[model samples]
Structure formats: C-alpha cells, structure tokens
Target: MAEIVPDVGFLKNGKLKTALLQHKALSKSGLSERLFGLMFSGLVYPQIWEDPDVDMAGMELREGHSIVTIGSGGCNMLAYLSCQPASIDVVDLNPHHIALNRLKLAAFSALPNHSDVVRLLASENTRTNTKAYDNFIAPKLDAATRAYWDKRTLSGRRRISVFDRNIYRTGLLGRFIAAGHLLARLHGVDLTEMANARSLREQRQFFESHIAPLFDKPLIRWLTSRKSSLFGLGIPPQQYDELASLAAEGSIAPVLRQRLEKLACHFPLRDNYFAWQAFVRRYARPHEGQLPTYLKPEHYRQIRNNVSRVKVHHATFTELLSEKAAGTVDRYVLLDAQDWMNDRQLNDLWAEITRTAAPGARVIFRTAAEKSIIEDRLSPAIRGQWTYLAGRSQELNLQDRSAIYGGFHIYTRTA
Candidate 1:
C-alpha cells in the first residue's frame, strides 16, 4: 500500500475549533466542547445515523435535482444517488469524512461487483477486503483519499485495514457502542438480547427486563449527569443540554431510555438496521435483516451508475453554500447540525440557505429537542423565505427508523 506520514492535525483545524468552542477555555462547557472536538476530530460516525429513507421522502427528491448536504459517514449521499439526483455537493469540516466520502464513491465505481463492494464496506473480512482495496479500490481513489487510507496508525496498521476487520467497529461511534455493551455486561444485562426479539412484544419484554433497568442504576445515572459523558454519541455540550432538558427532572437517563425504547420497540428487529447496529454492533447479513437504502441490492446498479455525480469537500456547510450562485441548489439535508449552532451561526446558515435555494427547494434537518431549533433564532427576513412543513415533519419523524432524534424538520423555499 502507498504510505505517508499520518496527518493528525484535524483536531486543531480552525473551522472545527470555531464551530465547537463557544465558551471560555476554562469553563465547564468549554472543556466538554474541547473533549468533544478531540473525539470528533478522528473518524466519528462509522455509519451515519440519519435514516436516508426519511431524508429522501422529506426532500421529495426528484430526478435531476441538485443537492448539497453534509457528508458525515457518506451513506445518505450514496443513497441519494439511487434517486437520480443531477449532482451532489458534499461538505464536511472533518477531513476523515471527506476522505471517506471520496473513498465510497471510488469503491462503487471501481469494485468488481456488488458483493465485493458490500464485503469491503458493510462486512468484516480483513484479508479479502485488503486485497480488494489494493487491487481495485486503491487505484480508483484520488491521491488525497488513497493517502488517508494508506497512512499507518500508532499500531502500524494501515487505515484501510479497518475494512479487513469491521470498519464499523473502529470509529468513535463504534467505540461508544462497544462501551455501552460493556456497561450492560457489568450490570448483568446482555443488550444484544434485543436482537433475538422475534416480535415487538419480545423486544419490549427484553427492554424492560434488561435495558430499562440499567438507566435506573445509580452508577448509570451519575455517569449520565455529566455533559461530557455523551460526547461518544457525537453530542456536543449544546446538544447535550437540549437532550437533558427533555427529561422531566433534567436527568438524561430518562431521555436516553425513551430514545432507546423507540429504537427497540417501534420497529421489528428484522427490518430496522439501526436497531441491529445498536444491539448487535453491526448490520445484519443479507438474508438476516434489511440494510440501509444505499446498501440494498436493488439500488447497487443505480449507485454505481450515479457515483460520478458526487463531489466531496472539506469545509463547513455555510462556507460551501457561500460559493454557490443564488437559486442553485434544490435540496439540503442538514442532519441535526443545527443543534450545535448558536443564534448567530443559525442566522448565518439560514441566510445562505435562503440566498442559494432554488424555487421549490426543500431543506430537511433534525433537532435534539422536540421542536425546531430555528423557531425564533433565524432573522425574520431570511426565515420568511421558507415555509415550515410542520405536519410533514411530524409524519416523517415517526417513520424515521433510526429513532434517536427528537424531531425532524422540513422547510421549503417559498415561491
């Protein structure tokens, strides 16, 4: 594999610092924010959490629609290709995410077949995956992306070797889930038992018998009281506050319990891959359970054919939007990022969204709180340009298989 000195300066990247540091250096919130920045600097979401099916439906995606979205783990962008979007401009502050998105595009274009791509990306088989990467995917990657995968870790393993193991088991989210399993084990609870639930009743029974009791433990309650404890879930200080606020007594334990319950009981384990990832630490096999929309077999050909339409950039969404001509983009997927923004950041983002949105453009996002984050934060003039589809947002939020978010929002550019 091609090699280079590993680039580890992403934690200090100015854009990330500016976005995450909203408090004083010595303050409690500031320290939590810094910790989150450090954790988020590395690969965070091994698999993006937002449900692409809900996203596509909310955007009302149409053939040839131009889209601009944050590239977290790159799943939704690939899924959008199945809808035949004309172009997708993906931006992220994390360089790792930029590289991951580019790598996925290359894998789709260069891998020999759907099965090879699936094994390399969605499954664990180190030798075959590493061989496939060296022979096929590596040559297709851009210089920057190839370098990212080829760089050696502290253990001296090439970054691409993650695919040889389980790539989903290596990132911050993966570590978080693993930690959750460990915690449950310590409490004599087998969280993975939720996956064995053959029906909704069994799922609820397992949750009540096993998962629900963990939150009531004194240790679990104390640990969750700290805002920094949730950085593993990619929840920064601001969003943590929002989640805590949802609980009647300001305890995040109840909030977490409710979310986990929705994840476990709202959908059948056989159909909800989000539940599978939560309880099983990986997606189900092809014959075992449903997969993400992008990973489903029927969409493979369309994703491959449309892979060339994606362009990945390492930048903030506002920065990327400022460069676009007015009335250019037709769809926007914000992915709960607004939860991390303050009033100024929210206004600035809406300004760009309003300025660049084409007629009939649709914007969809999620919130950590039960209501829209932009309710009164956005300046009137900019906010007036869009209509909030409250009914549609609620309907879609209910259908979101990844049931972690408190709310899903949709805003359409006013004619």
Candidate 2:
C-alpha cells in the first residue's frame, strides 16, 4: 500500500483521475514502460546526482524548515540532515529505494563507528559488509525492508550479499558504468587514472589525453545513439527525447560527451566524489580528503544525531504533498522527476505544490534540457505565485560537482 509508480500503474494509496489516462499515454510510451519496469524493478540509483552542496546553496534553509526531497541513493538525505532541518520526508516510487534508505538510516544507528559505515557504503571492503549488515543493521529494519534485503537470491545467499561483492557495480547505473569502462579500455583508456589527478589542470589534461577521444569512436557513437543503451543514466523515453531535442545537430552523443567532460574535469578529484564513483567505481579513501558530506568523518556524529529527523516513503511526490497541510513545506527538491510528466501531470503536480508551499517556500529541480516548459505548461495565474531565480539557478548549476544534468532551477513562492 505504500509504493507508487505513476503511469506504468503500480499505484497504491492514491489514484489518478480516470480522465488523465490520456495524459499518461502521452507521457509514457511502450519502450519507456518496459525500461521503467526494469528501472524501477531493481535498484535504480546507487547514488543521487543532483548535488546537495549546490542545492543547499540555493535553498538557504531557515532554522526548523521542513524539507521534502526525492530519495534516489539516499546520499543527499544524509547531506540535508547536516543542515539540521526540522524534518525531512524523502519519497520514491521504487520500494527498493525505500529499503535502501532505511538500511542507510539503520546503519547510522547501529554501526559501532564511522569507518564501519564508510566501508559498508563506499564499496571498499566487501567481505565484512554482509556480516556488518546482519550484526548491526538487520534487527533494526521494518518487516518489508527486512524481507527485501533478507530475500535469498538465486545463488542461495541473501540479496544483501551483493554489497559483499561490489554494490556500486551492481545496480543499473553500476552496470552502465561498467560498460563505459569496458568501452574505455577497448579504446586504450583507463578511467581509474582519474583518481590520481591533483589539480583541475591535471584533470583536464588527463581527460583530453585519456577519456575525451572515446566519444568520437564509431563504436561509442553507435552505442550512445541507441536510446536503450542509456537506461543506465536512468533516462526514460520522454527524457531521452528531451535530450535529443536539446542536443546540437539533433544528436544526444554530443550532449552526453559534454556532460561527461564536465563530470571528469570540472572539479578537483580530491573533493568530487561523484567523479570518483564514475571513473574509479568507488569513493575516495578517507585519507584523500574527498567524499560526499554524509560520508566524511567530521560530519558523522551530526548525521547520526539528526538521522531520525528523516522519514522515507514509497509514494509519489505529489501524493505526499497533497496530504500535507497547506503552508507546511518550505524546501522541495524534485530531482528531475518532472521531466517524466506530461503537461497535465505537470500542472497537477504544480497545483499541489502551489497549494502546499509556505510563503517564500523554495523549489529546486533539474531538467534534461536547459529550458523547461513551466512558463507554457503552467498558466500565468498559477505560475505567478512563484518567482524563478534564473541567475541563482545558473550560478549553482555551474558549481554542481556531479555535472550530469543540463539545467538546475530554483523557484520561490512569492506570496
């Protein structure tokens, strides 16, 4: 009764209007259904991409402001906890994501120390992770989440046992990253060398020398052209079309190349854990002074203390907001989910957001294209309630350490 998947149907608790079925059809296609089934079926994200540091910069959260965000890998939830929000509700359509978030919270509560937690999550030493999970985390989970990680795989080991191998390289995104590494190796590139760069200049030099040429390879060009091939980036058919439209010369390859270049070179390897996970397939070592905020040692005690302020739900963002009292939520992070909605769905979502937003409430989201249709999709009467911060959005977008998205937008409810 908790999980939700909007158009591909697996809804529970809330129901869409019968009249909106056409909008569902317009938004989700046959290919998108099959892939979305696959994407939502298993673990979709091993980490969240919309940078928390950039998001925090734009949100400028007040003391005790309630925050709502979409939980992907649950990394940013922990990051947000560091800011000492009054409460945080993280919703997702995937039940597996719900379980993962619970597991992370459980780990923070039950683990003996921060290193155990880092090793468990950073995918560094896999041998003891399952034991750690069983010993520290299992007794703390709810029945459904417990049944999820406890379910036996075909190999006769617990499903959670995958972490004991390489959880980062296991999910859809992980498999996609593995494929990219395979392709890079064939072209005589070593993605792991990205971990060694000491400066932005060295990062750029390494990328130009080692990684950038792979994009021009005919094999790579052919692979990137196949939309099915990008399921790892978690792009649905609708979002793929958005990228196609935004791409130069009507090709997604160039857009992806530019984004990958940004991921590889825009930030120092020592601080950009997103780049480390992309190229090295693991987080930077603790000694390296590079990590997501939640993973760093200095923040551990605070995250541990504030972890209880977070609650995870397997539901759509609108469903969660619709049920909340008016003027209750102040900070919202959409995490690019709006890209999947059609015009009607977009309007429906915004209607609920506008209704629930407190005065001066801020909303942040990413888009596959640099420009979004919010101006057209939403009537001026409805849209007038919020002011979009174009300058702030662009400024923060440039500083996004992850750099996978095309646009990052911030909007505030003015009245």
Candidate 3:
C-alpha cells in the first residue's frame, strides 16, 4: 500500500465538518459542533479511553486475523500487534493521530531496546528524549511523519519534545485532565488522592468523602450542563446529548460522577493504568502499576518484531471499508466514533461493514448510552445480517477498565 499523505487542512477540506455539522449554521447546536470540530481537528486523546483487553476478548482476535480499527492515541493498535495479526489497518481522520501512529511504529523499529521505548513513550523525564528521536527514530520515519514531529509549536519547541516532558500531558485530553485537577484544587480536593488508595475500600472512601460531593456543587453542575465544556473529552454535541440523557435529572455531573466512581473503586490502582493516567497524569512504574500491553516489557520484543504488520490511514472507517474486498476483514474496532454519526452515516457505515466482514467476523464499539445506538437507527436490511451479542457486550462492558463509556457493543456477521 502506498503512503497516504495526511491532509493537514481538516477544516478546509470539510471532512470533520461533514461528520459533525448536523444542525444549521447559526443554530446553538451548530456553533457547538463547529467549536468541537476545531478542537478535535488537532490531537484529542493522548491515550485512548477504550479498554483494549475488552476489545481483544470481544473480537476473539487470533493469530493471522486481519483487523481494522480506529487509531486513537495508537496504544491499542500497538497492543493488537501482540496478537500477531496478518495485517492491522488503522484509520483515523485526525492528522495528528496519523502522525502519532506512524511515529510509534518507527520508534518500535528504530529505538535500541524496550527501556528506551518505555522512556520515550511512557515516562516523564528530563532526559533528552529528543536525542533518541534524532539519533534513532527520526531516520526511520517516513518524510511526512518526520516533518510532523519536527514541526515547531507556538512555544518553538519541536512537537517531539512532548516525549521529554510527558507526552501524556500534551494533548487535549491531557489539558482537560489538568483543568479537572485545577477545578478540584479550587474546591480543596486533591484528585490524586485516589491514586494513593491501597484498596477498593479506601478508593470508595476517598470518592465518597472528596470526589462524589463535587457533583452536587452548583458551579460543577452548571459547567457540565453546557456542551462546550466537554469537547476536551472528545464528546461532540450529539454524544453529549446521549450522555446527558442518561442522567435521571438530565444533569451531566451525576453521570460523570458515576463514571469517575467506577474508575476509582471498581479496579485496583496497581493493576489499572487507566486509573494512573486519570489521577496521576502519568503511568505508574512497572512495579507500582500495570502498563498498557504494548508498553509491557514481556510483549515488547513481540510488538517490535511485528510492528511492520501495522499500517495507518488518514480516512474514515466507512470510506476505507468501501475500498476493501468483501469478506476480507475479520475484526473491527470502532471506538466511540459511532456516537457522533447521524442515521444516514450509521446506515452507510454498517452497509460497508456488513459487506466487507468475513463470516463470523466481530465488530466492537463503545457508546455514550447504555443501549446500542444502532439498534433502531440502522436500516433493517443492513442490520439483519449481523447478530448483536447483547449478553456478551454487557459482560465485557463491566470488565472495561476505562470506565468512561456507557456501553460496549459487539456484532458478529452471521450471513
């Protein structure tokens, strides 16, 4: 496959606008959508929120399987490399994500060893990571990806400098987490205390004593009520409505509180990297906490050896599927992108998914609501070809350590 150079002009090209602008310009929803597109056109997720363990289990990924997934933050895509898939095609509309994915592949191939890879990707250090990039990774990158990292920010720091300071703290999601910490500090709460909890009981106690009460604050409730406040979470207006609808009183704060409680109390801090990122703004060291599968030392050699199997594309899932032969792909991971789609987009996406999926192929996606968003929205003709794994989806949803999504859905092509 030839390299598809990323078109950095996302707004000018109108791809993002077409996906997000569901209401008329000048309307309240339209302005919110436009604002979200602008914010999302750049990097959003510094680390993807969906649980890859749940994804691999739901898909039942096997050696030599052909997989296609959205490349958010590139963690899960690298994690999937451990499965030794024949091919992993990653699709994303964001140019920065395309750059990031390509950079990870290059780092795996070019860096000296596992610890160097970990230091560059997972740790926050004063060590000159840029030297590692210059001496090793940069030369291995394709011209487009190399340029992306070399590009200077307003501060004049090279984009790759994020690795030195803490790449996890650099994206929109990172800024959002920082802002949450600031808000909590103003209320005399240090959210990082959740990370100090040594047991589930202590976790729950911290939440009940310090975190849970914030949801009832007049200011917190008011801020969450507005749609613009959640763009950092990558929740567009459409998804925000779905999330807000889940709250019995139509307030997003309670919904947020519920999710936070699960994130803090449902999983042990020592085994959940998602919790570490949420509370501490960086991953825990190897002995202190678990790391993402790709970052784990045991899997490092396997992922590095298989990095060539992964490919990143700057395109939509439906668009990419349209170009593939029927019955070619065995697994699909959509993340939460479906929550942002309209009915027509949903139907078009499923139409191609059904066409391109191999028999017994699996599709996994996350949603902002507990119910499957496509349950009634997809046209029956397109929807009937696949069976929804409701029980299995619910089972896996409970196991997802990320604790952010309201639903995790699985569909298997049967005909």
Candidate 4:
C-alpha cells in the first residue's frame, strides 16, 4: 500500500493542539479529522466566487481546444466552461471535492429549470430543495456520493443537513478559517463584522486593527511556523515546509498576511467575492439572482456535458502527468502543488509538463515564494522549453482567495 501519513500535527502536545481546537470550533466542525477523514467529513466545497475577469484577462481560450486543470473547488473549471472550450479535464486527489463537483454538475444537468437549480444550490431554500435532490440529483449519484449525503452526523442529521446551515465555512479550508477566527476572537478580534463595512477604506481599517494583530501574537506566530498546522487549509506538510522556507527569518505569517492584505486592501470589496466567502459565510445575491457566473444559465449545459472530460483519482501531479500522451494538454493549472514536491518530484512533473505540452500551451500555477518555485531545481532540457510570465501572474495573483500563497506563475511551453 502507498504511504498514508496520519496528520499528527494536531495531536502534538499543547500549544498547537489548542490552536487547532480553536480553529475547528470556529469553522463549526467539532474536531479536525485525519487528512482522508477530513475529505469525507462533509460535502467539502469551496463557495464558487472566483474572479473570472482576472482568470481570463491574459489568456485566449480558443474553441475546440482541450484544457487540463486542477479541480480545487471546481469554480475555475466551470468558469473556464463559460468560454466554451472543446473540453476540460479536471483532476483532484480529494474524494470530497470530487463528490461536490459531481453534485454540482448533476444539479446543472438534471434540475427542472435554471431558477430551480439556483434556488436549490445557491440560495437558502433547503426545505423545498431536498425534493429537488431526491427527484433530480439523488438517483443519478454513484453509490459513494449517495452514501455521503445520506450518512448521519453525531447530531443525527444527515450530511445534507448542511444545506440549511452556513456551508461557506464547512469544508477543510473552512474549518481552518473557522479556527483562525476563533483564535483571533480569543485575543478579542472578530473578522465576521468586516463583511459589513460599507467602504473599502472601512474594510482596510478593520483588517489593520483586527485581523493583522492576530499574526503578531507569539502563540499564533509559533504555531504558524510549523507546516502541519496548515493541513486544514488542504496544504500537505511538504508544501507547508516549502512555503515556510521562503521567509528569510523562517517566519511565514507576516508574509502571508501581506499578500492577503493586498487582496483585501487593493481590490474593491464588491469585486472580491473571495473576501466575502472568508469574512462572511455568504456573498451578495440580487433578489433571486442566478448562481455565480461559472454556474450561470448560459454555461450549465456545456459544463454538464463536459463533465465526463474530468476524471478524479487519488494521485499526485507527476503520477497523473505520466499517463498523458506527449504534446496533448494546452493548459496546466497546478495551484501550488509543486510546493509539496521534493527535487525528484519536481523534476518528474516538469519532465511530463514539457513532454505533454504542445507549442505555445500555457501552464499556470501558484507557489509559496515570490520567486519561481522551479529555480535551479528542474532539468535544464525541461526548463528550457518554457517561458515564465512572472509579471502577469503577479498582477492576476492579487485576486487569489488564499492570501497565504507566495506567488502565482504562468509558464508557456515553446518549441
């Protein structure tokens, strides 16, 4: 059997345990589960509030081109569908995210109408929605997903009970965020109110006063130093260590706060839907508005049809890339997965990326350092075929949800 690393960082003695416990309480989950357990603990979805304008600005999504991407929350996958790609192949290691993506596609495909789909999935109308799930969604689900929603929690409510609950903070990252909120609250700071700020200046002032101070606490600083505390955010231990290594002083929280601060301070609150998800458990909805643009009426049919283009499995990027035919994919969205790689893994991934990418194809991903994550680490032959657009990535990166990331990179394969 392949190695399954139990996330013992949570169980490490006192200070870390307390921080983890606090985050769990705030995210609304009672306790942190093992990495695999965390994936299956709930529906585990990211609120689909991606900044589409930022994602599509520089790239040209031509019709009839196949694209391969990492299905983080599956938001970007749907967003890309709006451009009408010939196909999109989405991959992820987490089964919870896979189930959530499948459910979303099913909702788009089988729901009676656009309005019904929106009300059932986006709006808070669960009492009537269960009928929709049963009639349209339930029968279509494979056994695993059907069982996931049917399974009861300790309180005797099914996991589907989250439909009526504030599910924004329900996923693995949500739990970490919840924990961060609680730890901040322990020191007398509340982030929930930041969502109500009427102006950008007001929002900036609030983050400066409340959210920024938590990073200064010695206890929080110490806890943030360890890579394992980040598992709740879906960052494995190796990525955490790489991200921490970027800091000259070996401190990560301040650098992370700075990047996040840019997301909160520079961008308009109305456009920054990611901020809305992090601070408030919801986004602004027009009276009977449709779902996010990616899930809109126009894109639903195509995204559902393209659903088979995506395949989810438990494997690393290198393992998956090894199976691709040479010169196949046009776009690769890594999303900082390389930060988890050792030198060999990094070499293997780039070798595959180099082998699989066609001329002018783009490979985009984020990292934990301001510099390119592959500097001096990749084989010269593999690295030479690519041109990294550092400047453009820096510009689009200001819109990313996790302010904790170091940098975003877009590399184009050349002949």
- Model 4, position 42: C-alpha lDDT score: 37
Model 2 misplaced stretches (Cα beyond 4 Å): 1-28
Q: List TM-scores for all candidates, in order.
A: 0.97, 0.92, 0.97, 0.82
| lDDT of model 3, residue 145 | 86
Better of 2 and 3 by TM-score: 3
- Which should have the higher lDDT, number 1 or number 2? 1
Backbone Cα, N, C clashes tallied per candidate? 1, 0, 0, 2
* Shift in Å, residue 125, candidate 1: 3.3
lDDT of 1 by residue, 289-398 (tens): 98878888899999999998988877788988999999999999999999999899989988998889999999999998899999988888988888999999999999
lDDT for 40 in candidate 2 is 50
* Per-candidate alpha-carbon RMSD to the true structure: 2.3, 3.2, 1.4, 6.9
Global lDDT for candidate 1?
Answer: 0.88
lDDT over C-alpha atoms for residue 362 of model 3: 94
The per-residue C-alpha lDDT of model 4 at residue 9 equals 29
Which one is best on lDDT?
3
Q: Which 10-residue window of candidate 3 scores lowest in summed lDDT?
A: 1-10
Cα error, residue 107 of model 4, in Å, equals 1.2
Please rank every candidate by lDDT, starting with the best: 3, 1, 2, 4
lDDT of each: 0.88, 0.81, 0.89, 0.66
